[model samples]
Target: MTLIGENGHAADTLTGSGFDFGEEPNPYGAAGFPLDRRYSHSLYHDADAEPHTGTGSMENLGFGAQFPGHPPFRASESFGIAHPEPFIPEIPQAVPDSQARLSVGSVYRPSLGARGLPDLVPDPNYVQASTYVQRAHLYSLRCAAEEKCLASTAYAAETTDYDVRVLLRFPQRVKNQGTADFLPSQPRHSWQWHSCHQRYHSMAEFSHYDLLDVTSGRRVAEGHKASFCLEDTTCDFGHLKRYACTAHTQGLSPGCYDTYNADIDCQWIDITDVPPGNYILKVQVNPKYLVLESDFTNNVVRCHIHYTGRFVSASNCRISQS
Candidate 1:
C-alpha cells in the first residue's frame, strides 16, 4: 500500500505491524454510513461500466457523424464538471458518548519461569488448562486500556478514528450513544470466555504479548495471555467512574482503566529455544478491533530487551499505533 503523509509527500519506508489509519470504508454499503452494520450489499465488479450511449451518458437516438447545431447534452451534466469531495474518516474532534479509546498502559514485571508451573491454570469450569502449561518460557507483563481517549490527545489531528459496531437483536433502540448515527454491525461477541476463572472474561483478544529477536528479525516467543476481563480496576484521573463489570456490563468508562497483573495465568510469552541476545517485547491491547474506540493508534507498547541465558532486562519502552 502507498503511504502519504500529512505534508502531502511520501513518508519514509516504515516497518513493523500495520495500523488502522481511519481510511474510508469500503463501498459495499448502502445504508446510514458506509461502515454501518445494516448496510445492503451492492453490485461490485459484477456490474459493467456505463456505456457512452447509455441514458444520461450521451445521445442514444440515431445520429450522424456530426450534429447539425450543437452536441447532444443531458440534464445530469448541469455542472459540466463532476467533483465529489473526498470523505475523510476523521475522528470527531469533540468526544462522542459511546466512543471507547483503547490503549495499552505498560508491559511491566517481566519474569522468566519454567514450563508447567503448578497451579498456574487451575480451571474451575473443568476445562483443560493445557494452553498455559505448554509454554516453555514465560515472560509476563501487564496490559491495560482506558476510556480517557478524548483526554489523551490535545490535538484532534493526531488521533486515528474508530468506526465500531456490534450485532444485536435490537439495533434501532441502541444507537451510537446519544447521536442519531448508527454503526455497522459485526458478529456478536461475549468479549471472551475463560475457563480458569469460570466466567466471561476480558474482551476477546483484548491484549496480547510477543517477544521478538531484533537481530534476526524473527519472533522468538508468543504470549498465551490474550483474553482479559474488562473492568474498572483503577483510575488516576478525576473523571467520574461510570462502568463496572459487576453489573453484568462490559466496558471501560472514561477515567477508568483495567489491568491484568503480570503474574496472572498464561500471562507470559514462551521463549525457550531462543538464544540469549537482543529482543523486542511487544504488548498490545484490543488486537482484534473488537471495541469501538476513539483512537486506533496507541494500541501497541514495545520495549527493548537484553536477554542472557538466565536473565532478561527491558528498557527503552515506547508506544505507537498498531
Candidate 2:
C-alpha cells in the first residue's frame, strides 16, 4: 500500500515483506465490524503451521499491516525553530573613582556583544553607581583639557559611621560620540544622593562630607551638595556663579529650651595639571563646638560624614584644536 502527500510525493509505503504472515484478527475491529466475522474464510490461515497459526491476506491492497518509518527529528546547532534569546550583559559595579580639582575618573567601559549577534534585551538590574560633576568645567571653560568634574553616590549618611556606595550607570551612547541616537531618549541616568547638615548635641552649627576626585585623589565636593542651582545674591545680594553650602538647623530637647548646636562645613579645593588615575572615596567627619547647651559641662560635639557618588568622567585629556 502507498500513500501520497498533498505535494504528490510518496508519504508512506507498505509491501508484503513488511507484514507478518502469521498474525491474528485486528483487536480494534476497525470499519464497524469484527475482523474474523467480516472476512470469514477469505482471511488467510496457516495450513502447514500449528493449529493456533493465523495469517493476514495479501490480496487486499489497502490493508497492509506495516507503516513506513518516520524521518529522524533533527535540531539546529545555532538558533533553531525558536531563535535563541539575546544575551544581555550585566553592568559591572567596580567602575573608576572620582578625584580632586573637580575632575572625575573616566567611567569603566562595558564589554560588547558577539561580532555578528547583538544584545537586544534591556538590562533588568540597573543602578546609579555614583553622581559626579567636574569643578573646573563648572566654573570657567578656561583650559578645556584641564577642567575638573565632581560626582556623588546615591546612598546618604545618617550617622558618623556610614560609607555610601553608588553604582555606575552609563548611557548606551555618550553625548558627543559614536551612534548618536542609539540610546533611548530617557536613559536610566538620574540618581539621588543622601545629604545631612544639621546641629549635633547642643551646638548650633552645621556639618558636611566630601567626594574626592578620581584622578587627582583630591576631594571633588562634599556629599551631593556640590551639584545644585541655589541662591544668586550674596552679602549685599551680589551674584556668585559657583558655590557649595551646608544646611544648618536648630534642635530642641523639649522641657528645657536647647540653645546650643554645632555647625558643619564641607569645603572643596580645586587643583590643576593633575595626572588621570582611578581612586576611591572615603569620608571623614570632625565635630566642632558651637553655642553651649543648658548642660554646658557635657560638651556635645560629633561630626557625621558619608561617601556618595558613582564613577565620573572628565573631558578626554588629548587637546584638539577647534
Candidate 3:
C-alpha cells in the first residue's frame, strides 16, 4: 500500500519486506514483532533499518499484542504519550551580599535658601501678599556596603554624549515578596552620578521627590534633581565630593547618608501661593525600577508636615510601604 503526500511525494509505503501483517509471529518475535537480537542489530548496526520505515519492526510504532487476562493495551498509556511530566520552571538564584542597595534615610524641610549662598527673596511679581515662600525639601539616604558595588565605566560609543553613566557591575537576581523575579539582566546605561553634589541621578521618573498636600492628596510641588552625596555621614548641608562612584571603592561609601544640598534649584518646590494647611511630604528613592535593590518597599519616606504662613515644620517622617 502506498500513500502520497500533498507535495506529490511518497509519504509512506508498505512492502512485503517491511512487515508481515500476518496474525502469526515471524522468526524474530510473536505477532510480527522483532526479537531483542534482531531489534538491537537493526537499531545499532543497520543504518537502513529506520524506525519510520517499519524495517525496525511494527512494535517500535507502538503496536503490540495484549496478554490473555490483562486489559486491552493502549499505545498512549504504555508509551506516556497522553501523560507527560509536569513543567517546572528554573528557579532564579539570589543576589550576592556585595551589591548596591539604596534606601531613603530621612525626610526634612529646610529653610528656603541655597547652602553656602544667600537666600533668594521671593520676587514681588511672583509672590502675592497672602502667599508664603517654601524652600527645598531634603531626603537623606544611604547606599550600604552590601549594596554599594557600583563602578564607573565608559558607556558605549553610541552613548558618548551622556556626560554621566555608571555600571552596576555585580547586581543580584532578587525575587520580590510575591515570588516574582525582578532583576533579569544588567542594564546598559544604568545610573548617572552628578559630581557637583555627590549624588546619583537618573532620567527615570521614580528618581524625583514629590510634595503632596496631605489633606487633599494632591501633589503641590515636585523636585527632579534628586542628588545625594555618598560621603556625608549626616544630613548636614556641607560641601562634599560631587560624583563618588568612580571606581568600586570611591562609590557611595557604605553606612553613610548622602543628603541633598540646598544649593541645587530642583531640590525644592515653590509653595508660596499654596494655602497654609497640614501636608504630607513623600520622598521616594529610585522612583523607577531601573536599578535592582534588595528591598524596594523601603525606598519611600512619608512625613507629616505642618505648614503655617510663617513657619514650615516636618514631623513623624518614616519609611512607608512601597
Q: Rank the candidates by lDDT, best first.
A: 1, 3, 2
Best by TM-score: 1
Q: How do all the candidates rank in terms of TM-score, highest first?
A: 1, 3, 2
| lDDT agreement of model 3 with the native | 0.33
lDDT for each residue of candidate 1 in 112-226, tens digit (9 for 90 to 100): 1211100011111111111122222111111211211111121236433341211000000000111111111122253444444555554445555667778775776654444
Model 3 CA lDDT for position 275: 67
Cα error, residue 93 of model 3, in Å, equals 13
Q: Write the per-residue lDDT of candidate 3 for residues 149-210, one digit (tens) a residue.
A: 11112222443332332110000111112111222123325656555445454333323445
- For model 3 the local lDDT of residue 11 reads 16
TM-score of 1: 0.42
Model 2, position 268: C-alpha lDDT score: 27
Q: Answer with 1 or 2, whichever has the higher lDDT.
A: 1
Model 1 spans > 4 angstroms off? 1-193
- Candidate 2: worst 10 consecutive residues by lDDT? 99-108
